[model samples]
Target: MNEQSLNLDSQKVDETFFTVKLPEQVGLSDQLWHLSKLYTLGIALSYTYVHTPFKCPRSYNVGYFETVIEKSKSILNKFTSINSSSTDKLIEFIGLDKHELNISDQQFELCNIVEINIDEILKDDKINSTSDLKKCIEYFGLYSKEKIYSFVTKGIYKFESKIEQIVRSANLDDSTIKKLKLPEKYWKAKEKFSGKFSIDNSKVKITLHIRKGDRTCINLNGKLVSVFASSIKVIDSTDYRDELKQSLMDTTKAYNLIQEIFNKYGEEYFSVQVLSDGYQRTFFTIIWAMVRGKIKLNLNDLKQLHKTKKALSKEFNDFLRFSNISLVVGESKQNLFQSIHAIVCADILIITSGGFAYWVHNFFRKSNQPSLIINLNSCDNKVVNKISKFL
Candidate 1:
């Protein structure tokens, strides 16, 4: 465990990173955001590709590209650090003419698997920094007295804005939607507009983003008291209200489960918000929390090398980068565990577990979306046990 994210809070003598029981549900939207963002976070473990076109035998050209790729062990993760000599050798084997050779550069996608490491960052004192919280969290973990002020000043606003942005985009009452001023995009397919602040006139539905007042203590009353006073709140119909309520209830229950796990286990847990546009609001928030020492990587990121099927692994990275995310690409981790930590803390989940790490991640997926789970490490027994539950 990164000493930066976690420390011996109850250390009468010493503290250890044993898997302890947790009571509070550590369900934060950020966990899923980080998970989903792993496919999008732009922090690439970068190396230049040296293309060597292999013009195989006419018979070999008939072979599926997959077969040739597999023989070279060109899986998503086995990234070759290409150099000029390597490229030259590849060209020779491919039988390409030097005069005619023209190849474009391409990037090997990052593997979906991640390792979340809080202890490592903590040792180095790399907290998310908007202000001086970096220095404070370095000296103290998430709950340090010095960090408390910074948390309230910097962290709360940062975290609340994330949740608010997500809420504003979801279908909500016209009045509430207008007030929040969230990001919005028109859906040409639906002919109906959907955004952070949304309204469903056809469905007679309106959704309002209600922040977790008890947990965050945001600028709720300070601003809302005046805003709500000026705005005329709309009365919602029973059916429409029920649907939104159910959505919130279900999400809350899941979140509470994680919180319960955290309070009991004494582990770092957080939920990140998911946006309709596949934007990683939660992913950004954790990086924000890391600055404040509110969240850090867990111990699991260091424990194992998560495995996955090669194709699914490659596709996962491709989908996100293709989606046009610019800030970060893939979860900010190397190896399986670090990515896992970033995802869990970031709160965005991809919904598929067809890979090696799927076992531990099965329960974390949304039940309705079967395809979201990415199967990378498909053979492990523990990974299988977790995946089988949904099946």
Candidate 2:
């Protein structure tokens, strides 16, 4: 749309254009990571990248889906372009007949369509490391040049050990990181909360993510109070419920270990904030049960004016009245970015096992302040190994 702002090189008259077509079932975080990969590859190969906006069903913020895509394109527009032309137009521009186009081909020579199959690549035992994966991509001539070295460098590796690099490099000054900034309201929330707590340099400020929503209700744990059970798909399996309950208990044990670690540091005091979708009763129940009254609830006054129902139970109300834990309830709603903002602000983060958590961890891998992160699902030996250093 803004040609000059796109920063396209005028000297390069002839350019290769490519579009990244992600799988239909991809989540929002995975979608962004794949786009980041495409952006990196485009820069390395001097290819013009086209973005095709995809649907995200799990997203709570309806506007955020479009906002991120547009913001990312504007920030990283050197190779990014919108889908302004039709498939017929693209075929015509490539000088290929519609009938001759083989949809099953791995790579369309004229119009490059990168079909990302991450699961397939990860299955290979030989491709265990990022270096190995990079070589494989190069070997397949995905973005290989005669003399140009591998664009997926060690710089990205230092930030995250994962194979998929979320950015072009680990340099935070780059536009890749800048593109991740959410709307102004989310930032304001962060700024407002940042001043309320006195974050100790010696102590760790931990933020644990306990994901409870329609999607994770069955797989992770059954809701303590099924307020929206009618909306959720009911799976009729006692074994499934048992497995999920066990997993949740394991996570609860991890939380207890974290509490003990803080206790050993000197005091058992630590700031706990629960970022939930809305005023979900299960979130309150889980936190009250696990945290044992070491928590603060900061409710937005403006948004609080709109909520009609008081979702708290009589027991929770009684606990709040006598306990030292703070409770400030209001009508304000929650969004996905707000949760992410909380993650970014935390010094120690314990997240659920899912794509969303992994994406947030990777995005802020090389944070300004050091953080101790534990994935509840994978925190047996791995988390215990990291715990000795902090203790």
How close is each model in CA RMSD to the real structure?
26.7, 14.7
Q: Across residues 316-341, which tens digit of lDDT does each residue of candidate 1 receive? A: 23223222221122221121222332
Worst 10 residues of 2 by lDDT: 89-98
TM-score of each: 0.16, 0.45
- Per-residue alpha-carbon lDDT of candidate 2 for residues 153-228, written as tens digits (9 for 90 to 100): 2122223333334222332223442333322223333453455343344444555665544223323222221223
Q: Please report how far candidate 2 places residue 125 from its true position, in Å.
A: 19
Query: What TM-score would candidate 2 get against the native?
Result: 0.45
Model 1: CA > 4 A from native: 1-237, 269-391
lDDT of 2 at 297: 27
